[model samples]
Target: MKIGIIGSGMVGRAFSIRLAELGHDVLIGTRNPIITLGREEPDSKGIPAWKFWSLHNPEIKLATFQEVADFGDVIINATAGAISIEALSKIEKDSLKDKVILDLALPLSYSPERSPKLIYSNEDSLGEKIQRAFPESKVVKTLNTMSYKVMLYPSLLPRQHNAFISGDSEEAKLIIAKIMEGFGWESKDIIDLGGIITARTTEMYAPLLFQLSKIKGHYNINISVVSK
Candidate 1:
């Protein structure tokens, strides 16, 4: 599958590398194309440089937002929640028409002291808002319930974790589920919590993940769904 990932942050870069490793044609969209060139060093976060070195497929090119929207068979929105709409707005509406967008962003807004909080509430979610804005695009919300480290490679961990996907489009959800399975996630491990309305619950997990990251001093944990 030809996949386009917007945002060059940890999540975006991580997914690009993993998907590329899995033999998928991956294109990364970033504000600055130089980052993909690997000319400069990475920040203290240890993400940017690592991704550049780890990418096995040189075919994974850095492209403009519009190029990504046009090039992808499936578009993955990995941008920060506050800027997700802004980023998508820059792309020509027609370019994303009838496309499947796998949304992994959270509705986070930054304040003075706090890190970020969900700008949306229980009544609405980022997924619904994006779907409303791009009615022609099928948006499936998934992979927001865990950290970037666990998003693709979970078997390395001691226990298996669960991920949730929600969207009104059954066809889109099935495609996302198959993609997830390719990335080392098991079918039984992923929960399809009905349509996009359930995205509120999935989005809410972001704040909880933030709190847990603070408590554990790590962002590599996962949420396991265990049946009794």
Candidate 2:
């Protein structure tokens, strides 16, 4: 499977390497290839520049946002929540036609006082916005509530945890669910909360997840749905 992932940051690199290791052709997309490749140092977040990371993993390739979107069988949005739509909008409408968009981004932003909050949550969600923006494509939301490490390596925690997926297209959801399975997520561990609207709750989990991470001093955590 050819997978195109938007964003050349840690999240995108994590998925690119894991998926390529799984025998899938992966391409990571960024805004400016020349500029991104020129940076020798890490960013404000301390993530290594794309050029350095690209050297270690030559199997996975890089391209501009639109180019990767056109090359992929399925497009994964690994971009930050604040600019996900802008990044995706770079792709032409025809390229997105009937394509399954696996969205795992949240609309996170900080206030003037540097307080964390969701740009769109509760009443609306980034998944719903992506669906609306690209009506021709099927958008499925998942994995936004957890860390990228846990996303590809669910077994790292060693427990019966769960991942949530929501989309208007059942077929699209199934496709993404299969990919999640490839990442070592058991079939029973994946929970489908119905249509794309359910992303409201999933994306809304960011604040709580962040709080928990702050308290624990680690981002490695999982959500388990217990039942009788």
Q: What is the C-alpha lDDT of each candidate?
A: 0.85, 0.91
Return the TM-score for candidate 1, rounded to 2 decimals.
Answer: 0.88
Off by over 4 Å in 1: 32-57
RMSD in angstroms, all models?
Answer: 2.7, 1.2
Residues 1-228, model 2: lDDT tens digits: 999999999899999999999999899999999889889999978998877777899887889999998999899999998999898888898898999999988898876675479997778999999999999999999998889999999998977899999999999999999999999999999999999999998998898998899889998997999989
Write model 1 residue lDDT over 12-131, tens digit each, in one string.
878898898898889889765665565457765665563455465465577888889899989999998888998889899899998999999998888779967889878999998899
Which candidate number would show the highest lDDT if scored against the true structure?
2
